[model samples]
Target: MTTPNSFLVISALGKDRPGIVNALSKKILDDGCNIADSRMTVLGGEFAILLLVEGQWNTLAKLENALPELEQELDLTIITKRTEERTPSSNLLPYAVDVVAMDHPGIVNHLAEFFSQRSINIEDMMTSSYAAPHTGTPMFAVHMNVGIPSDLHIAGLRDEFMDYCDGLNLDAVLEPVKG
Candidate 1:
């Protein structure tokens, strides 16, 4: 049995600071809302926040109304929308892809294009640029979690992707992610 509830997916962006999350979480508690799941990170000088908030219908409404004050006070930009809690898919196979190469433009773009052409779904991705270990040359790395349809041929996909990476001068590996 499922209980009746409401969910709000929120994204907030603003200058990084000491108290932004604390303030928001405290306010949510005061408004009788619960934090369902969240990921917060700092990108350069700015902070990015994404969270799913759960509560009853009326309390969720009240929290929504109360947010304008925080937006104005913190000079933050916020976007919120009602959302459904999604269950994980059992029909797709999880695969991990990692790439390392000289920091160059179009690497991520080309990778995205390749996956999009195959109708692949990217679940999550993380990328970073740093100095090479031996030399001081800039290096880029990307790790992504992609969902391949169960009907897709993993061997063919792996072979084609490796060839594509070789053409791009990128070192890449694709392997199944553990359950």
Candidate 2:
């Protein structure tokens, strides 16, 4: 039989600071848990953390109980919950999408809504706004990794997406991701 509560997904969000990672890593190690996978980034002045970890039942319980104190001490907001190990699937092919346009509100929402309506899954996305080198015009850019189901037609999809971008005066490209 499988052991109870042996794996967990932990999320911590707070103001960016110097010691967040170190403190969390030290505590996790001290409690005999292994961090299986993690991603951390600073977004809009807030630090966000995501972690997948594995440990024994008591270890999980201890961490669950101990996190609140750490959260309070560090001024962090955290969520921890049990989860099963994930298995990879090959049903979808990876694609890369890049977008460029003058900075404006609703561009991100529109793109995300378009993908959502088409049942496309975005595995990762990064966006930034910066000034153009020569014109000094504010520009927005997005780079995304998407998973497209094998049965979907690529050419028509890209054409439609690009057409939509064209209406917004945005330049966009979608292509198969290279290893």
Candidate 3:
């Protein structure tokens, strides 16, 4: 049997623009690397990409070399680090939380602070806003998929969040994440 290859994580950040993916993928392809998984998105005005890749150990140099040109061409930062495989956690349960409120600052910061205090793991989060009809004011919304520890008290967490939300003049909802 063949030995399993190790994986590398690549993270890239730059101004939002086209061709970032094409350039990055071309480099990976040239280096004979395979992408295991990746996440790419435009956050505010910045483009961020995270990729998990696998290939022969020595090909890492080729992968590194492939980035500088793109970095200069696109004015972005690219970083790569190796990762070790670990046994998947079977005990963790995922849940979703949705927050909607009148547009205001610090919504994300406040929510993130709360999660940080509780050591809650956010698997994914997305936030957006749109102009409310006639009012012409923006209405903000946030959706987060989080991993909740089995021992954590959901009711207590909800109460704490509600208190914070009240102070912020926002509507918050927490419910069991249904698959």
- TM-scores for every candidate against the unseen true structure: 0.92, 0.88, 0.81
Across 81-104, the per-residue lDDT of candidate 2 in tens digits comes to: 899877565988899999999999
Q: Candidate 3's residue-wise lDDT over 11-110, tens digit each?
A: 9999888888998888888888888888888988999999988887767667877777877887988787888765656666677889998898988998
Return whichever of 2 and 3 wins on TM-score.
2
| Among all candidates shown, the one with the greatest TM-score | 1
Quantify all predictions' global Cα lDDT against the true fold.
0.92, 0.91, 0.84
TM match of model 2 to true structure: 0.88
Write the number of the candidate with greater TM-score, choosing between 1 and 3. Answer: 1
Clashes of 3: 0
Model 1: how far is 22 from its true place, Å? 1.0
In model 1, the number of clashes is: 0
Error of 1 at 60 (Å): 1.6
Deviation (Å) of 7 in candidate 2: 3.2
Estimate candidate 2's RMSD in Å: 2.2
Prediction 1 TM-score vs. true: 0.92
Runs with alpha carbons beyond 4 Å of true place in candidate 1: none
* Poorest stretch of ten by lDDT in candidate 1: 1-10
